[model samples]
Target: MQNKKRLMRVLGGGALYAATFFFDFDNEILNIAMFLLGYFIIGGDIVWKAVKNILRGQVFDENFLMFIATIGAFAIGDYEEAVGVMLFFQVGELFQSYAVDQSRKSIAGLMDIRPDYANLRRGSEIVKVDPDEVMVGDEIIVKTGEKIPLDAIVIEGESMVDTSSLTGESVPREVTVGSELLSGCVNINGVLTARVTKEFGDSTVSKILDLVENASNKKSNSENFITKFARYYTPGVVILAVLLAVVPPLMYSDQEFTKWLVRALTFLVISCPCALVISIPLSFFGGIGGASKLGVLVKGSNYLEALAQTEIVVFDKTGTLTKGVFNVQEIHSEVMSREELIELTAYAENYSNHPISLSLKRAYGKAIDNAAITNVKELPGHGVQAFVHGKEVLAGNYKLMKKMKIAYFKGEIMGTVVHVAVGGEYVGYIVIADEIKNDAAIAIQDLKTEKVKQTVMLTGDSKSIGEHVAKKLGLDKAYTELLPADKVEKLEELFAKKTEKGKLVFVGDGVNDAPVLARADIGIAMGGVGSDAAIEAADVVIMTDEPSKIATAIRASKKTLSIVKQNIVFALGVKGIVLVLGAMGIANMWTAVFADVGVSVIAILNAMRVLNTQSIHNSTVPAWEGNVEALSNA
Candidate 1:
């Protein structure tokens, strides 16, 4: 409604200005009145704001500069030029408001993910209430097409959830009993009843909204410089304009005060600084909005700037480069058959809930008979000991075999090895490995194509496993057997190796990785919704676990920075050249208006280019994927 009123005022002022050109009113008083009516219509707010600012001792703003220049033009009998300057300046202001609104729309669209209400299930009755009113441990019923109101564990029903809002992937994720469901996902297929695990304030959607809302407060260095530049630049130009007007008439008796005053007003019009003040911040804001469209949440422009300068990208092995879930890869036996070996290992590991043990049981794919198993004991960092069918069974690492005085053969394998022993005799070993993510290799290649100097992996896994995965992915270096503290120590070493202006980025997806994530120059958390600690500590969050998005983020940041630099250079370059011409009277008030307003419009349009990120996302595939495919064909 306010915009509509402003638009009407601009149109009315513009119509009056057009009248003077077409119809000639020879009466000077009548012509001046008509022009004054037009000027006050569009520029009244600006003049009023300048008055208020002056009263408060906050003078020399863009409003004050525009008011002084246009009012001076009226005083010099250039009525048309005075009103035309205000008309064009208002047009430029309108364009800036529109560009900022468009950028905001990209992020505002995500606000729909916040659930309006939740269906609370209490015994035989279901009641609807605000999502914030629903407490943890309450059972919530999510109907088909309803957004999940809070983080929960599914207790009944199965459905496909549309996680595109949170993960960016369009594929629907299947959920069943015992599956964890995050807030903001839509229940696409079936009704589901889940026990709420978190309150609305701590849910994924709430945190994401908070992160995005506060993102603009953390400005880049370029934005800070522009703010400071404008602070000093505006007052300095105003003082210079005063000197140009007063000193010239005092120095030369023949110099007319009105002629020099016109030049001073033109100088003030050219020196508004609107182009630099508006376009630089808009460029960064547009870039951030574009990134959010691709499901990448950059916490601030400062982080975006740092991401563009990343030289070394360090990664955690588990849940980062590789799927943290283990799978049984291979099995070898001497005294027992393969099936017998797996069966015994599965039964021995039945009581343990470790990922390695779970993989063994999953590979076994058979129900265990508790009557046949007895006296199970799990040793930390080793393995499990139990009796199956009256035979003593020891299933663990090679250390367990040596502790039992049983000779065992260590196989040449790139995985975690669990050795099996029967009645103090070595039987066989089972190899369990964490599978590498599909895009891990392509991600590494993309980073290299971006000219990253080093790509390193830090892992708590054994050396053999870490080196094998690193070699497969073509990483520059891999440090294995690292604890959480050791990963931080290694990051410091890598940090020292980076160029002074370059940054080190660490990517991880675990609670233990929070320290390293916070320590790095820029930390990116993968599968951000799955880990609260990672999301809290990371500077940027990749909604999906895809490593390729790292390259995508870098590309976005670099493009945004490029646009910002272009605006800075283009705005200043044109303004600088024209300001000199205006002072020497080579440029008229018309040219001065273009130098101030026209340059601002052009810079704003250039800044809007950052919001069109479809091309950036389309080019996110790393260059290595194509080269490797070509080599294979040869």
Candidate 2:
């Protein structure tokens, strides 16, 4: 629809410009003929819409103003001026179409993330099916080289998965049985059996699609202000133009009415309200486009603007600070050998579904031949009880050790303490700690480098664990033992601490973090493994679960803000010069066209520069200048 509207406008402008030359030969007849053609080609629709709006009691609009201005110009036989007005206004329309198309292209990049269909394996039958048709718990076979259809669990087989499109990482990750696979990740090699865990509509890819498609609904702050400015600016200019035509001639007793009336025509031509109107929205559209190219999906221009104001960034500990993959770092024991302890611990934890259990089993150094295992029982909310080789083995917390009639003397423990009771005697605890995200420290340092004033972490983890993670990351502060509501309180405190010009942003990726994520000034979610609650609540959704993207997002936001300011300054500067020239009766129609169309083109081109995500990390605020003035005096 937009393209078609743009086509008529372009054709109308070209024809009107050409009609001038052919009619220039016969002044009287030519002028009338050209004005008629120009009026019907451009102002006809405006006139119809104005009349229709009047009947509907929605009378005030740009179209009504345009219709009145052109007709008034033609009534005095100023055919050239009337055509020029139509021609330049149409040019502005074309410029707007181009900007809108550029925005659409940027939005299209995000739409590419949604999947079209899936390959389903039902017994011996392999049929092509829509991802929406696949049900939860249905076994879906993902072949080597195909994108995973939906969020699902690996039921069988193992393979290296390529999730660079989803996560920004270049390396392929190995996934085995019981691993949950999200949509948009491609299987690198090996056949894998997956059980669907989420429906297609609720998949991460789907939400991303919905976000991209509906992004335009939420107007950026700049766009909103421009819309309001245009509204008042248009009517104000029209009223002034009417005063110029009527009052000026009446006040000057001997003045020629045509001279003052000509000035009014020039005023109408200059007052098209296209540059500020087009450039502002174009700037936001370009920023949105550019950010998406870097795998950052900004919900609206408002979020982009909000991102630019961020001074404090809060993070969640488990998934956002760390990788959320627990690993058995070190095991301390006096009676058992390293190999014996790991074996017994793995044997005892075989039946548990906890993440720590899997980490211990992985550290066991040997695959569990399930057929050799004997009795296995699970105790919810605590740990697991199992018998290995007629030994009463217990693997749980300190409470579980006491429950099993074993005494556990508290020991100095750094990592998570997984208490063990082998043969009804308290053995030693395995130290299980969630591995920290490699980019955590660098991400924090990068945020500071990007002018982040305060970096904080909120977590439900113990203080010792939170402090250790925050210390490793070099963040400014850390808060621990936070429930969902507690995280919200911490966010509110961060908000209160910020300067009036600053904003507080929170990053979380768990079910417990959802409420705080929603309550934050800006929330960032690691879409992978992040609960639906977190994703739905977050303002900015990072498709990948990488901490580096936080820095990337900040870099993109600051860059976008720079471009937006540049566009606004350039557009207003050009229009201000032209508006002055128009009022003085020195500006020609060609100059007005250049101001309306040429300035818009430059501003739009500048806005498109935001799409280049490369070299985003290369730019810095040049801190040398800040401290160098003191050095010179010294």
Candidate 3:
């Protein structure tokens, strides 16, 4: 409660006790003195401020109205009534302050993610320095357990990087020599030597910080409405109070002039716009915070409002719905065991730079202990050859198998095909493909559950590949063979069909999907670090690559919109009833108290619910890939 309100309450109670002193003076003086002290503490400053502002030609404030009502009560010798009115008015101010702070706390947490220092490297020696001092082309040493200070690539060492803080992906990505790593990722293990490509403030993390800090400058619909409402509401109430004070006495006689004026003062006290001004913003703040906890970062409240209106969710196929990497899955062997085929493939693949080689290595556990190896050779975009365990090994596409006279059997070859040979004799084959993100299915299902009218996937992959993944996840539509530009075309077609009331949300990764991201009503970027295009185009970013965060963000939006509606109804409904009573002179201090503090408490409790999305989903792994390291203990 406001200090003003508490003081008034104590004074009012003391005056009530002093009313018993009218017939007895034995202890009445003490009660009267207590009542006087309470009155001065609560109303004296308000009265003084009103007089100063009136002299300064600003006479429409609540302080001005409060003084008039309390002084009228004093003229009528209703000491307790005067003090009670002051107490309740102050209570409303206290409640408004508490509500606004709670809302600010939500956004404040997101601001905290901005870091203050970067570890710099100087002449083979590592040093701690301010981020602004960082320069381009400088070698920076970001060790295990440290935030990447600038955008750079790994010059040496390997480790699993937990990018969930930036990309929303719970998985730890492996970084080796030549692999690019962005700022803000916590290096989990292994010393990383990075040569900075971008300076400190010019880096990816810096851009994100800059964007978020300025997000509120771009107002959403809801914020604009409250701003306009309060600007008008404050002045309108002041005008009504003036009419109430002057017109009531002129229109009716025989009633005390001070009595009608006191009623007008009470009306002014209950007419504060603080509840609307404070609670509406709180709703959005809580919603944003709630989404962040689920790994979804909303750049601004405008996006939060846009999300609630979303009816269609259009997803980019690669890195959005499906796992972006191609990996080996099944092996068809004629004579050699599956293990032997993969062993031969991995051994020969060690000499190749093709993605097929990487997939084979991943399938073979990347640990070929076989010593009997020699004559290693590789053909780019074709295959690999080597002598593994004293036997000839040839692993490539169907071209190698056809050259060696091998039979091809078909059964679910969704991924790349790697044919194997023992002593140049065709023995087996391996298939590799990019797998779907684990939570894609859950993300689609929850979208439908949340009243999302349509779910679609657009990809540059073949129709067969798109359909196979879509069927498994139950997407409503699939658009395959789309170039990055083609994606924008498709999004426009979808947008043309829907009204502004319903939105089209596009979920994508870095630069590859920026056009579609910008075209959609709400652009969501998955794995946002270093992808300047993604950060620039997207309004909401799932720092991790978790598809489930899309759903978490939607859920938070729905809940926040719901809370805002509840507060609007609550504050307006109570005030509506109280206003009628105050106008008819039937309402008193109790009604004013409820209008201020009671409504504020309800709105505050409703706003805090933005801390959670209320729905959680399970994790998924592809059919063939094995043992993905999700996160390092950090």
Candidate 4:
């Protein structure tokens, strides 16, 4: 609607200006009247803004430059040129407004995830309320196609959920009984009863919305430089225009006053810095929107700029490179079959609530009969002992087997092992380890392709396990057996290895990693649905919990920076050339108009390329590969 009004005004002014060209009016007063009417019709708002700014002590802006240049053209009897310059400038402003609106729509699509209403389940009744009114622990009913109002646990029913708005993955995830559901995912084809776990203010959707809304407040260094450059550049050009108009006419008798004044007007028209002022920030804004489409949330443009210059990328092992879920990977048995050994170990470790015991129970995948088991005893550092079917079964580490005088074979495995013995005979062992993420190796390989200097991992696991994972992923360095404090200390040591302009990035997803996340140059937290410590500490959040998205963020950042540099060079290059020609009276008002408005429109169109992320997809591994080694503990 606003663009329509602006178009109508420009057309009205252009029609009046064309009338003066074809219809010859003999009276000079009548021709001047027609030209003045057309000029004010197209540029009335700009004239009003210049007046308001001058009253507020804000002088020498783009509005002031346009007002002085066009009015001076009319004073020199170039009425058609004055009207044409204002008409073309208005056309440029229209294009700028439309481009900014399109860029905003790309980002505003993320705001559609904010839920408007939640269906609260009252006593034998359902009531609708705002999402903020919904409290923690309240039972909410989500019908088909309704967004989950808050983070919740599914208590009944089942459905396939559309997580594209949150995770950027098109495939719907299955949610059944006891499944955790995140806010902003739409429920498809089922009615679900869920218990809300967090209030709306603290939900995943709220945090992401807050992050996106405030992202523009933190400007990049390029944006800051452009702002400061315009502040002094505008006033300095105004002074040069005054000297061009006044000194050239007074010093040389042969120089006509009107000719030098016309040259001054052209110089002022060419000096407006609209392209740098508008397009640089828009480029960063489009970059942030592009990253969100890939399921990566950058909190600020400053962080996005820093990501492109990252030299070292450090990772926390558990819940970052690995799945952080304990699983039974292998079972080796000699005395009895694998099934019998697993069943007896599951019974022996049943009464214990440790993760290793749970993994064994999960491996068994059957109902345990407590009536057949008796005299269960748990050692502090060892495993457990129990009597299964009137036979003594011992399940523990190698220390327990050695204490029981059971000869056992300790193999070279890079995981936690559970040894078993039945009736004083050696049985097989079960290897339990946290599984590595499916894309973990691909993530490391992608980082190397991006030319990152070092890829490192920090873990609390033992040396052998860390070295195994490091070698599998082809990392440059691995620090093992580090506590939370030790991880920070190692990070500090790695910080000294980067160049002065380079930045270090830390990625983690646990409460223990909060301090290290806050201390790094760019802290990326995996799983937006993860712990509160990780969410609050990170500068960037990857919603999909995939380590590969870090490389995607870097790719997007570099693209945005490339566009910014292009706009700066292109805008200044054209304006610099025309400004010199205008000062020498070689460039006319039409040429000055192209240097200002034409360059602005082109720069804004170039900045819009940052929002196109189809080319920034997952990169394949390169033909050349790095050697796999645990290079340093640091």
Candidate 5:
């Protein structure tokens, strides 16, 4: 409704101004009244704002510039120039507002993931209530096509959940009993009853919304420079215009005061700085909105700027380049049978909850008698030491065997090796290996195609396993057998190796990786729905857990920065040439209006190109080769 009213006023004032050129009124009073009506109709709000700002001692703004320049034109009997300047300025403002609205719609689409209400189970009946009113541990029923209101664990039903809004993956994930469901996913095709694990305030959707809403407060260096430039540029130009009007006519006897004053008015109209002030930040805003559509959330524009300068990308082994889930692959026994070796190893690691230990228990497939196991001690950075069947058993790495003075044979296997010792003597070892993610090899290839100089992997796994995965993925370097603290030290070394202007990006998905993630120049967290520590520590969050999105993010950042540079160069270059011409009396007020308002509209249109994410993503990745055998082997 407000837009309609403003549009009507602009059209009405524009029609009155156009009529003055076609029809001449015989009476001077009538001609002056028509000019006054059009000028005040188009620029009355600007004049009122200028007065208000002057009273509050906040006078040097766009409104003040337009008010003084147009009123000075009217004082010199250039009534048509006065009305045209204000009319074109309003048209430029409408275009800027429309461009900003379009950018905001992209962000508002993501905000639609917030659920309106939850269906809480009460006794024998289900009642609808606000999501915030539902407490933790309450059972919630999600019907088909309803948004899951809270993070929960499925307890009684099977279904498929659409996770596109949260993860940007189009395929629906199958969920059964014991499967974890995150908030903001839509339950599809089944009735599911889940026990809520978190309250509304701590849910996944709330955190994402909070992160996006506060993102604009953290500005980039370019944005800060433009802001400070505008702060001083307006007042400096006003002072220069005062000198161009007063000092030039007084110094030269032949110079007319009115002609010099007209040039000064044209200069004020040209030096608004609206083009630089609006389009630079809009470019970054569109870039962030574009990234969200690809399931990559940048917490601020500063991180986006750093991502564009990335030269080295470091990846974590587990849950980043490869699936973190472990599987038992091979077992070698020295003296005891394979069955006996497996039974003793499982018993020694019974009390542990590591992925390797769990894989051993799963392979054993039998419950151990906890009464027989005694004196279980866990040794960090090595392995576990426990007494099984009245004999001391050791299940750990080669370091543990060397510490106990037990001679062990090393196996040439491309996996993590768990060495076993019985009564201080070498027995056997088990090989546990993790499968690489389907997109892991392609993700590395895509990074290289994007011109990333170095791709490195850091892992706590054995040297053989690390080198195998790194070689398979075609990484530049691989460092293995690193502890949590050792990972930080290695990162510091890599940091010094980079060029002075180049940046290093670290990607991780575990709690142990928080230190290295924080230490890098840009930290990216994978699987934001799963790890709170990763989300808290990372500057960028990949919601889908796909390493390919890293390439997508870098592509988007480079495009956004490219647009920003284009706007800065175009706006300044045009204004510089036109300002010189206006001062030399070669250009008029009409040319000044085009220099200020027309350039702003064009730059805003250019900035809006960042919101086209389909084009960005399509350009980032190449067409997939249909070689299934090669992909699986990789």
Candidate 6:
């Protein structure tokens, strides 16, 4: 609506300026009055803003520059040029406003995840209330097509949720009983009853919204430089413009005051600095918005700027590169078939609640019959022994086999091995380990391609497991058996190794990783499965839990910085040439208007390009599942 009004004013002023041009009134006073009317219609706000700023001791800004230059043109009796320059300037301001709004909307659209209302369930009665009013442990009902209002754990029903708003992935996620449901996801196809786990203020949606809203508060080095440049640059240019108008005309008897005054006004118009001041920050803003679309949330432009200089990338093993959940990897059987061996072992360990036991049960893929098992005995440091269908069965580590005097072959494998012994005879062993994420290898390789100096992994897992994963992922370095404090200490050492201009990025998802995450130059947390502490400590959060997004974030930061540099150089270079030309009386008010407004519009258009993530989005492969070694070598 505001833009419409501005557009109308521009059109009205433009028509009047055309009338004065084509059908000039013979009387100079009548022609000047018509031009003044047109000028006030288009640039009245600029004049008002200049007056208000001058009263407030903020004497030199774009508003002041435009006001002084165009008013001088009118004073020189170049009425058409004065009103025409103001008209073009107003058009530029309108374009700038529209560009900024579009950039803001691109970011705002990503944060459209905030739920307005939550359906609270109260013993057969359902009430709709604001999301803030929903408390933890309260039961909430989410119907199909409604957003999950708060972070919750599903208590009943099954459905597919559209997580694209949060994760930027269009594929719907399946949520069933006991599944953790984050706020902002749309429940697509079922009515779900869920127990809220966090209050609205602490919910995922709120935190993300708060993060994005506050992102602009932190400024990058380029933005700070531009601010300081404009502060001193504007006043300096104003003084120089004043001297150009006054001293040159007084010093030379041949030079007329009006000619020097017109050149001075042109100089002032070209000196606006709107291009650099506006486009640089706009570029960073667009980059952050683009990253959010790729499921990477940059906390601020400062972190986004630092990301471009990232030299070292450190990773946590569990919940980062690997799926935190353990799964059976391989089954080696001698006497029994793979299925029979796993089934018997699953029955023996069915009653236990260990992760290995759960993995065994999951591998079995059938309901366990407790009636078939009898007299189960658990060895605290070893394993479990139970009777399955009257046959003596044991499923444990090598210690259990040694303790039972059973001859077992201990295979060389980089995982937790569960050996099985049936009636004092060695059957086989099953290997269970945390599986690496589908994109883990790709993430590591892409970081290297981004010119990262080192790709390192820090884990509390055993040396063998860590080394195996590091080798499989083709990481440059691996430090295993490190405690939380040890990871921080190691990060400090790595920090010292980087150049002063380079930054270190640490990625983790566990609570223990919070300290190291906070200690690093930049911390990236996997928001989907990340602990609250880790996420809070992180500078960047990957909402989709993909390690590859780290590379995507770096790519975005570099592109944004490149755009900023281009704007600065281009704005300065063009303005410098035009300022010199205007001072020499070779350039007119029209050239000055183009230098200030045309450059700004073009730079803004270039900045807007950062918001288009299609090229960046399409660059990533689905999942690099080939040989990590071959890719690393390549």
For each candidate in the order shown, give its overall lDDT on alpha carbons.
0.86, 0.74, 0.73, 0.90, 0.87, 0.89
| Model 5 ranges with Cα > 4 A deviation | 19-23, 331-352, 361-410, 418-430, 618-634
lDDT of 1 by residue, 1-634 (tens): 6566668889999999899899999998999999999999988988999999999999988899899998899888888889998998888777667766765676577545888899999889999999999999999999999999999999999999999887777889999999999999899999999999999999998898888889989999989999999999988998989998999899999999998899899999899898888888888888877787777889999999788898999999888888777888778897879999999999999988898899999999999999999999988878889999999999999888888888998647667789999988889898887777778888898899888999999999888778877887899999999999999899988988998999999999847788998899998998557678767889999888778888888988999999989988898899889889888889888898889888888888898898887766734454443222211111
lDDT of 6 by residue, 319-400 (tens): 8898788878788887779999999999999999999999999999998888999999999989999999999999999999
Model 6 steric clash pairs? none
TM-scores, each model vs. reference: 0.94, 0.84, 0.76, 0.94, 0.88, 0.92
Candidate 4 lDDT, 591-618, residue by residue in tens: 9999998999999999999988887777
RMSD of each: 3.1, 6.3, 6.7, 3.2, 4.0, 3.2
Q: Deviation in angstroms for 466 in model 2?
A: 2.3
Stretches of model 1 off by over 4 angstroms after superposition: 22-27, 110-112, 618-634
Report residue 231 deviation for candidate 4 (angstroms).
1.1
Better of 2 and 3 by TM-score: 2
For model 4, give the 10-residue run with minimal summed lDDT: 625-634
**Poorest stretch of ten by lDDT in candidate 5:** 624-633
Overall local distance difference test of candidate 5: 0.87
Q: On lDDT, who's better, 2 or 5?
A: 5
Query: After TM-score superposition, what is the CA distance of residue 288 in candidate 2 from its true location, in Å?
Result: 3.2
